[model samples]
Target chain A: MKELSLNILDITENSVKAGAALTQILIDEDASTLLLTIADNGSGMTKEVLQGVTDPFYTTRTTRSVGMGLPLLKLAAEQTDGWMKVESIHISDDPENHGTKVEALFHKDHIDFTPLGDVVSTLLTLIQGHPDTDFLFRHSIRGGEKEVEVHMDTRELREALDDVPLNEYEVIKWIEEYLNEQYNGPEDAEE
Target chain B: MKSLAELQKIKANMKQRIVLREGSGDIRVVVGMATCGIAAGARPVLNELVKDVSEEGLSEKVTVSQTGCIGICQYEPVVEVFEAGKEKVTYVKMTAEKAKEIVEKHLKGGQVVEEYTIGAYQS
Candidate 1:
């Protein structure tokens, strides 16, 4: 339902929320399918955790955990005749070896994936575009294999890492709100 | 292909704005928008500047623009404010709420929020 960008942005926000150090987003736009993939280096959740994530009422955080991301992501992918799968390894060679990868698929002819603003807005969330974080985005469209790559670093937005101030938060939120306005195609776009 | 003259005409129209001028009576806020800025959440910050300025009726007094990159990607969502007769104030890690505060304090009151300014790090 709606454009796949909304799902893409939604899932990506989850990645940012998962305390990911680096998030990589890959979008494949073709005649057959408009595919979006988001990968992050956050703590890997177990099968039970993953299952719990899909349950709207279950939450991992004691604070606020509506557990809507994975479910919504699953729904969006299924609606587009695509599927979302999560693979996690608890026992890895590295301590920080946790990771999560979510993929959303879409039938190109049946859906409009040309509106890229949603994808942009999703990736520019509050936690995103931070100095400590780095993102690699690749978009392919037009079947010419025509493509574009956008690498956004947090440093470009701000430099003071010692302590985050109120002004900094305002500027970032303002930008987030701005992107939400520019990319209006998706209502459930983590707006 | 489009005609070169048409491009020239478009340029002429854009020139009416005179974006990069030596002396103008407008408050210019530049947000770095390279890959880093976007990752640093600069797009929303820039967008809010436009919305807030317009809503607050500061259209003629302030203008929001985007830059490719500011090199420093850490303090993203960065916003640099420049008035006609004042120093350049760089507000780092900006958000929608903070943008409003800046509008109220610095933009309106002619007072810079020193806490938000990247004082020693001015490059």
Candidate 2:
């Protein structure tokens, strides 16, 4: 992917395809490292699938002969002296307990690492696209002693909406503004 | 940040239209958004479809959605349109500009832009 947000978007789509009812994304950027974690309460992959997930040649979809999401992320991470891991636990009776987690770590200063582009747009797309699914996004940046964090929970937003859809144009515009203000600070708010 | 009061007004206006569009055999515009598609520049095409459809006030009659890979990696950035009681039309190697044309010629004008179709490219 050209941007880290695009990679996040692609991986989250995989979570949705895996039948996730709730997905949590955590991004932490420090002076030296950037970490991304995507966890989902979905149908966890089998050991066989998990083993071959990083192989671009392996895919579960009949419409496509290759799956590039995991592999591409792995390549991107590795290019920056980073690594990735995928863990899954399959549960037949309780889907809430069955899920998968994909995590990748990259060196923040690495030249090969792509920038996080328009993350607000990425999260909003996922939320609007899957209205029934709940999403929790946590982003944090740490430099020296200063740390800034932003958290967005769709479940809480839904309750506040009182039946109004999150994808409503007005609501989406609000969400975009909310994310920007939170991520970039109020001083840099977009007019 | 805008308040919930504004959203309430939008909900009141959109509820009926949204209900009518759901599960109905409306014109469905599906954009392929797999890794290959995105790498080949599908995001802009998808965004254009959403923007144009809404701008043309065809949101109630048309649904612009996304899908995973369609198995045609060579034909990246593929878009498929499915209308009620009609054959599916697949557009290949789509760009934002072509998406606008499709939105106008096919979606709004009710005539397929056959030149952009995969069949046209092949034959």
Instruction: Summarize candidate 1's per-residue lDDT along A52-165 as a digit string, tens digits.
Output: 666767766454544455666666566656767776543243565778887767564545333334555555443433435656666656454444333333433333222332
TM-score of chain A of 2: 0.93
Stretches of model 1 off by over 4 angstroms after superposition = A1-6, A63-65, A91-96, A111-116, A126-129, A142-191, B1-123
Chain B only, TM-score of each candidate? 0.73, 0.87
CA lDDT of each prediction against the hidden true structure = 0.59, 0.84
Q: Report the lDDT of model 2 for residue A138.
A: 98
User: DockQ of each model against the real complex?
Assistant: 0.04, 0.37
Which stretches of candidate 2 lie above 4 Å from their native place? A62-65, A93-96, A144-148, A185-191, B2-9, B16-25
DockQ, candidate 1, comes to: 0.04
Model 1: lDDT to the true structure: 0.59
Per-residue lDDT for A20-108 in model 2, tens only? 88899999989999999999999998888889999999988776467789999999899999999999987664545889999999997
Quick one: best lDDT, which candidate?
Answer: 2
TM-score of model 2 vs. true structure: 0.88
Q: What's the lDDT for residue A190 in model 2?
A: 65
